[model samples]
Target: MSGGVDSSVAAFLLAQQDYDLSAVFMRNWDTGDESGTDKGCEWEKDWEDVQRVCKKLDLPCQMIDLSQEYWNRVFEPSLKQWESGVTPNTDVWCNREIKFGALLERLPAPTTSNKKPWIATGHYARKSWSTTPNSPHTRPRPKLLRPSDRGKDQTYYLSSISEEGLSRALFPIGHLQKSEVRELARKHQLHTAERPDSVGICFVGEKAKFSNFLSSYIPPNPGPVVDQVSGKTLMQHAGLWTFTLGENARIPGMKERMFVSSKDQLSNTIYVVPGSDHEDLYSNTLRVSDFTWIWNDAIPPDLSTPQGFRVDLMHRYRMHSVPSTVRKAETGDLIVTADEPEKAVTPGQIAALYDGDWCLGCGVIKSTSR
Candidate 1:
């Protein structure tokens, strides 16, 4: 439950419904804070909060240590992606592997044979249930829907989750806005009612910057920063992994500000452009691999056909979506052609598709055509 207000509220809401429930607090990262005195260190404080809320609600709470699982499953793969100069969505893996996969499996078995135990979370996403299925085995269809709180909707992080895992998932607070969640927390006198929302990566302390945290794991590898247009060496960089596409490039002597346009992982070099509107930073088409269709497990649209299968595409969390068409390429990869060129569509990041309120599918962007 992350010891946050949303999760506390979620538990309270579920408890109010009179369903037998048990709270689980996952310890994904140790944070290496042995002293436990670091003010910004969230592990100890978050655990205490979880205990407080569970005690107040008269619910049994257990701490599951999944630090090694997180390191092997989520962090290691992400480290390799960054080292290879591709930005991976680590949270997506965390939700799919740890939260839904491992934690759900560890839940106590149901008391009755017919009653299936479900795992509840603070994720701001809704599920629409339908008894009529597309086939015999798929009797009930659980469609992932956008929560009432648009800004806080977390379906993007959960795009890679499987149908079986989603079937046993519940998000009690998805119907309520963030403001209403806090209000409900206050009404219930929960300890997390006034706690500030945690920010950045879960392992990184609140006071530490993401760059600083990353530097510890990835040693500095010096490389040249080149201009994409002129092919001229502009400056030297500490590491290729330090920069992200579309972020500012603070060159020492250059008067005009530049943005990160691209990177060459083979040469360990970074490429930059003069401005945000640079031609090198936008893409009209992109190739995606490791695609998953959450709604229907059918073959993707054929690319040879006339621009069929229209869907709204999102490149990142909370980013404005653009109209796009999905088609299967001859190489067995999914190709997405946007109606409008998208800026800084980075490789190794997730690209999600939607139809109205339902999230259709998502894929890992392999490359983009600038």
Candidate 2:
């Protein structure tokens, strides 16, 4: 439940059903492993909250530690991507690798009428099953759909999990808005009724503390911060990860506000433009590789063809999907071209596809160009 109101309401809503339900809280972060202190991530308190919710619902609950899985599958990969001068959405990978992959695999086999053990989370995403299967012999396939609350929909972060993995999942409060969830929690007198939403990645803590935390793990590689228009070096940067595209350069004593237009890892330099709306900050095409379809066999029929597949693509969470065409190369990589230019489509970020409200899947963006 992450000691949050959303999960508390999810457990509450599911408790009204006849099916068996037991809360399993996964602890994916261990502060002991990091610099040896519990500052930001408080898994113990979250476990306590989960237990309280389960107790109120008259259900059993247990805590499972998945820190090792997170470190290997999510953190390590994110570190590598960050070191390469791109920030990967670790939350997206955490869902695929830890919550759905390792933790789901560790669940005990169903001993009851249900053939496979099902997992329900507080994720803000919806799912549906189709009678038509990918192949005649296979059962109905699960489609990841957008939640009713578009503003709160989390289908983007959920696009990487396999179809089979998605089939065994449930989202109890996917239809409700954030306000409705808070109201429901309050009506039930849940302890977490007023708990504020958790911000950023749990282990990473607040945004202000992020660079400091990352510095502990990554050695500084000094680089030049240059103005894009003038091609003049303004100052030296400790690391490229310290700044993100389109954000204020935050350089002291600059008369006009400057924003990062791009970063060149090869040149070891950060290019800044004078303003946020500069054309240099946007791109019309993104290069992707290792594209993973949720239903691996269900690649769009025309994706590998010259015409490519028509799909709406989202490169960042919470951003509206953009009209795009995705084509598969002979080398098995993907090239996505957006109908309109997009701002800050960075490398190592996931580019998820959608056919209307249904999520197809995602892949890492290798690069972006005009």
Candidate 3:
């Protein structure tokens, strides 16, 4: 449940049904064990909130420790990506690896005649089954769709989920707006009716300085900061992980503002351009490694033909999808050509494709070209 209003309201709506319902809270962080003076995520408070909401609804609740799973599946890989100066979306992997990957495996087997229990979450995404005769398999296939509230659509985060994960998942709040969910909680007098929405990364959200949190794990590697326009070294940087592409590069004694243009790991150098809209900061082409289609067997036939299939591409979670074409490279990578140049299309980010409001799937961005 994550002890949030969305999940609380979702459980409340599910309780009105005849199916047996229970809440399982996964504790993915051990805040006290970290060396930082500042204790990390306050998971205990969130757990308490989950307990309070579950008690009022009379739903059985259990907490499971998934710190090891999170570290092995999501955090470790993300750490390596960040260390290499790439912005990997750990939140997206959390859904695919933890929520759907590990959690799905931990669910108990069905006992009664009515087996096959569906897992429900508060994610603002909708799903529907394909009823057409040309469906992938004889059985209907599940399609991940954007929620009713377009502003709150979360299909981007869920674009990497497997077919099985989407099929077994149910989202009660997909059709409800954020305000509507809070109102439903208030109308039912739920304990978490007034609780504020969560912000930032999952477990590390409470950390004041993200660099401080990361420093606790990765050691410092001093690097040279350089100017992109002129081949001149600016100054020494603490670490490449401190800055992100397209973010302000506050170098001392610079006449004008600077923004990150690129990072060269081979030379351990960070490159900065004069302004935010510098041509060096934009890219119209991206090479994605190992693109995964949700319906693997039902891949659009046109994608394999002479003319590449057109799809909307989105690398960041909140950003709108851009018109793009995808074609299979001889080396097995997927080449994405955007109709418009995209800024901050950083490496290690997952690029998701969509056909209208339905998310096709995603792949890790290998590299970019202007």
Candidate 4:
């Protein structure tokens, strides 16, 4: 539980259902002000809130320290992706590697004498079960779908989860809207009933800035910014990792807002162009590699067949899926043609494929073309 109202209510609702439960609070950072004196820092208070909720529910609670693993697996790899001028989804990696992956690893194995353990989180997404078991060893894998609360659904961030993981995961608050969750919390007299939601990174507290958090691990390298239209130098930036496509990076003389169109790490230069809602910034097609399909063995045969099928393609978290026709290229990479052009189809973003509400698979965006 991230010490938020949603998670606290999730635990409460699960307890009402009479399921045996244990609460775990993951401790991911140690550099913050532990005293909670900083203006926005509240790690200590958040922990206290989690503890109080667990106590009220009579559920055993423990704080697990996964700082080393989180840094090694999630943070470091994310930095490397940014250094190469690609925007990596760190939260997705965190959910996959730390929250679900390491947490399951640390739990005691199930045996004939012991009950199997299942994990529950406060993510706003629904899990659907099939009518019959799909395999002998286990039941059918849970299918991920949008929650009843359309505004709060988080299935996009969870597209990378494997079939095995989804089978054991539970989202207790998936069917409830945020308002309903708050009302339930209030009914239970939970302290976080009216608490504001956590912002920025999950583990990091309010005061933590992304740049400050990354600066400690990634050494800053100042680089030059060049105008893509003029072929002229502009200003220096603190580091390439500090910016992303469609971002208006600060420059010296250019008064009009400029957006980063591309970055060249080999030459240590960033390309900028005048910001506008123009067609040039968008593209109709993108190439995706390193594909993984959650539901099928390989990309659907229909995707490659002469008779094409339309699918929903999501390139980033919270962004609406764009309708597209997906086809397999000669080299085996998936080629996606958006019904309408998409803006800033950056390299390194995960391109997830979906059919209706079910996530079929995902792959990394390798390149794009106009």
Candidate 5:
């Protein structure tokens, strides 16, 4: 449940629907200090809370050990990205690997007599069902879309999941807003109703410093910072990994607020500009690799046509989608041309393609061109 109101209410709603449900708490982190205290992890309290809720509902609960897997799959890869001077979203990988991937691995296989059990979470995203005739299965593929409550839509984070993954997924709280979710939790007498939402990594708990967490894995390598305007070395920084695109990095002799425009890890140098609006920090075109399609078929016919196709593209979570034209580059990479210049289109971030609310697929942004 991640010790949150939305997930608790989701479990309650699933019970109300008479669906057979099991609450699995994933233990993803073991190193203490997650509670912002030296006394080891307080996730035990969270687990206790979840157990109480399960008891109230008379539903069985189990703890799945995914700590090692989470570290190997999500954290390690993210550290590599940070080492290469790219800001990676650990939450995105956590959802893909731990929440969805690990849970699917642990679900008991269904018997031939009944349909396979589906995995449900409290994500606030609309699941689209196909209505076309002659569809292959009795159940259509579930599409990921923005929740009716746009303010809390989480479809952006789930943009990289494969179509097969979405088919077996359930977002029980997709239709409810935050206020409604809290009300349902209260109505059901869920203890988590009044619990503060968990921030950052679930196992890591709230108040955990990102720098502290990162420092454990990536050693600080202080390097020189260069001024873009003066073309001169300004000062040194703790490490390139500590900064990100659009970040105002503090230096020894900077008179004005400076923004990070680029990083050259090979030379251990970071390029800084005066404002957030430096031309080099913007791009009209981006190339993406390792494309993953959410739909079952190949690239949609319209997208593959000679004329190509245009759609809305999103580079990061919570950001508004920008209109873009998609075409296949000579190397088979998806080339996206934004109608207007986009700022901070960072490499290693997924560029999700969409047609209105339906997610087409996503790929890792490789590079950008002015």
Candidate 6:
């Protein structure tokens, strides 16, 4: 449950429904402070909180350490992506690989034939069923829907999960708003009622910033920071991994606020342009690889033809989707061109496409064009 209010409430809701249920705390990372001193791991505290909540709910809970799995599956690939000057969204991989893939496999089978074992999570997304008669397979398909809580919809993060994994998944609190979740926790006297939301829990804890966590793994390259327009060196930065596209370039002794325009991994240079509205930061086209479509295995024929699929592409979580036309590139990668030039079409980040409220698929952004 991660000792969080949302998860606690999710468990409670599932229990109240009288479904055969059990709790499992998946320990993914080992953040034992790189110094190797007596500083305890934050996960230990989280584990304790999970144990307490499971006890309160009168549910059997067990801990499964998946540090190696997480390292191999999520962390290593993320570091490689960062090293190549592409910002990766590690949480997407975590949710698909560990939470749904590995942990779900460990869940005990149902004792009765009538009951089905499902791995439920606290994600703010909903799933619906539909049938596609026009397609080759005319069976019912599970479609990933946007949550009723509009602002809290997390379908973008979960776009990469397979249809099979999603079929066995359940999101108990997707229909409720964040306030309602907190209220439910408070009403039940759960310990996490007042606990604040944990941001970026996949890579780092509440105390450790992402830059600090990344710095521990990737040593500073100390490269030059250049201007995008003039190609003139502005300053020196610790490393290319330290910053992301569209983030402010906080160069010491600089007078004006500037935004990151691009980074050259070969030259070890960061290019910056003044102001958030800089034209260099926006891209008209982006290439995406490692595509996963939940609805259909093959790309829609229209996308391959001259008449491309008009889709809304979401590159980052919670950000509004951009109206775009998606087509298959000659190299087999998916090419998406925004209707209007969009800002920070980051490489290695997931490009989640949608048609109206239904999410079509997701892919890793490979490159962008200005």
Q: Which regions of candidate 4 are displaced past 4 Å?
A: 32-42, 109-115, 131-139, 203-208, 296-298, 306-308
Cα TM-score per model: 0.93, 0.96, 0.95, 0.89, 0.90, 0.94
lDDT, model 1: 0.84
Off by over 4 Å in 6: 33-39, 113-116, 206-208
Name the Cα RMSD for model 1.
2.4
Residue-level lDDT of model 4, residues 1-370, one tens digit each, is: 8799988988998888866678988876654434444445455677888999999999888888787888888877888987777878877777778887887778765454475578889999888976323334354456788888878768877888777777788999998999999999898799899999777776454533776666666788888898888888888877787777767766667767778887888887888888765454688798998777765443466777875668998887777888998998899898988898888888888898788887767788988887
Candidate lDDT scores, in order, read 0.84, 0.87, 0.87, 0.79, 0.80, 0.84
- Please provide, for model 6 over 114-188, each residue's C-alpha lDDT reduced to its tens digit, 9 standing for 90 to 100: 554788899999889887754666777788888888788899889989888898889999999999999999998
Rate residue 115 of model 5 by lDDT. 68
**Model 5 per-residue lDDT tens digits across residues 167-249:** 88889898889899999888889989988766766644453376666777788898888897898888887777877777777
Top-scoring candidate (TM-score): 2
Query: What's the true lDDT of residue 128 in model 2?
Result: 89
What are the RMSDs of all candidates, in order? 2.4, 1.7, 2.0, 3.3, 3.0, 2.0
Per-candidate clashes come to 0, 0, 0, 0, 0, 0
Cα deviation of 180 in candidate 4 (Å)?
1.2
Candidate 2 structure lDDT: 0.87
Q: lDDT of candidate 6?
A: 0.84
Candidate 1: regions farther than 4 A off? 33-40, 112-116, 131-138, 206-208, 299-306
* Candidate 5, run of 10 with poorest lDDT: 31-40
lDDT of 6 at 299: 56
